[model samples]
Target: MIFQLGCSHGLPGIFACLEGAAAIHFQDFNAEVLQCLTIPNVNSNVPSFQRPALQVTKCDAGMEIHFFAGDWREIHKLLPYAQNIDVSTGKGLDAQYDIILMAETVYSISAVAHLYELIKMCITPSHGVVYMAAKKHYFGVSGGTRRFLSIVEKDGVLASSMVAEVGDGSSNVREDQTLSLFFLFLFFNLLPCGCGHQFGHLPLIWRIKYCNRN
Candidate 1:
């Protein structure tokens, strides 16, 4: 199962999941917005124009598209009724999803800790993966991402294992004159909190691996 968080506009990630025929759990902060997506529409079309077009094209095709709309802070409410099972057993109805994909959702510092907690709760101990993508500018805004990182590190949930080294001997280079050529170093470490932080200057993607020994 795949969970798509903050799926606005349903771009690359959504389309990719569709291509793979994966079972998707789409989420957003607005119920009205999610309703609008049910009516298949392309990015180029105006909102009003796309709704009718989608109704005519795909609504009758029996496509079982799932959508969740609500504030990210209230994800429990946003989840489908069937998906929310007995909390007493410590697992939701859809426990242990194979992957969780978050896009453009980490820019809010206030939401980072909660997001990490949710991810940890939803994934199983064995083979789950969480992928997140965010722009460098987001981290610079009040250092929200950095602060979250610090909190995770302070809690001993993650260790800053490595930092990328770039410049003179780096292998990444671009031929475009307009683009500055820079070397990128990658970091591989365990995030004790189940979430890792990456910055704009960092060329490497940091990862958190579950440590079963402890």
Candidate 2:
């Protein structure tokens, strides 16, 4: 399972599909971008075969391909199989994604909170992880991984570990540390909704905290 947030050209999401992710959801801020650039790119790139177009639906049967164009805050409701994660309680959703990938999306300080919350909503609970790549700072934007992580810290819902940093004295993009990954675990409620799903035997369960609330 994979969620490609802010999938501009949809390259990363398409790559996931080519890599045979059971399901891949591509999201961006504009629908036109998807239709003009992303979809065409996908149509051209998917492994060409004599067969017809593959059917992608909500189930895990075939390679599920979904597209969404909108702000992160409102898009999750329309996202297939999006678990209703309660950020406050650190609980919700019967299932979660195996991997979440994003690149160069942390440039907006105002949107980082919504982006991180959405990640929590879409990611699988215990073993799920997010891999992000961005510069140490986005010049003139006053936004970067450092600013975004501060939001995560204040929320006390997720954890982060630095993955890599690259810098050479002479390069114009000096100290533009490459990427980071947040491997998070939380004990939150997984409630049953009208979808005929049922909760655990207990109406509520206190999940084991994932090591940090500091």
TM-score each candidate: 0.55, 0.72
Determine the backbone clash count of candidate 1: 5
lDDT of 2 by residue, 1-214 (tens): 8777887666656666666777777788888776766566666655541122222444333676777788987878777657566656644474467667676677888888888778777776777766665655678878777788777778777777554443444332212121222211110112112122221111111111123432
Highest TM-score, which number? 2
For model 1, where is the 10-residue window of minimal lDDT? Answer: 174-183
Candidate 1 collision pairs:
157-192, 157-193, 158-192, 164-185, 186-204
Local accuracy by lDDT, each model: 0.43, 0.58
TM-score of 2: 0.72
lDDT of 1 by residue, 1-214 (tens): 6566776554423343334524556667776655555223222321222332222222223323456666655675545432455555433455556656554465677777766656555654466555544332353544233444565466553332222222234433111101112112111111111112232232222233233412
lDDT of 1 at 186: 12
RMSD of 1: 10.7
Model 1, position 155, has a per-residue lDDT of 53
- Which candidate has the highest lDDT of all? 2
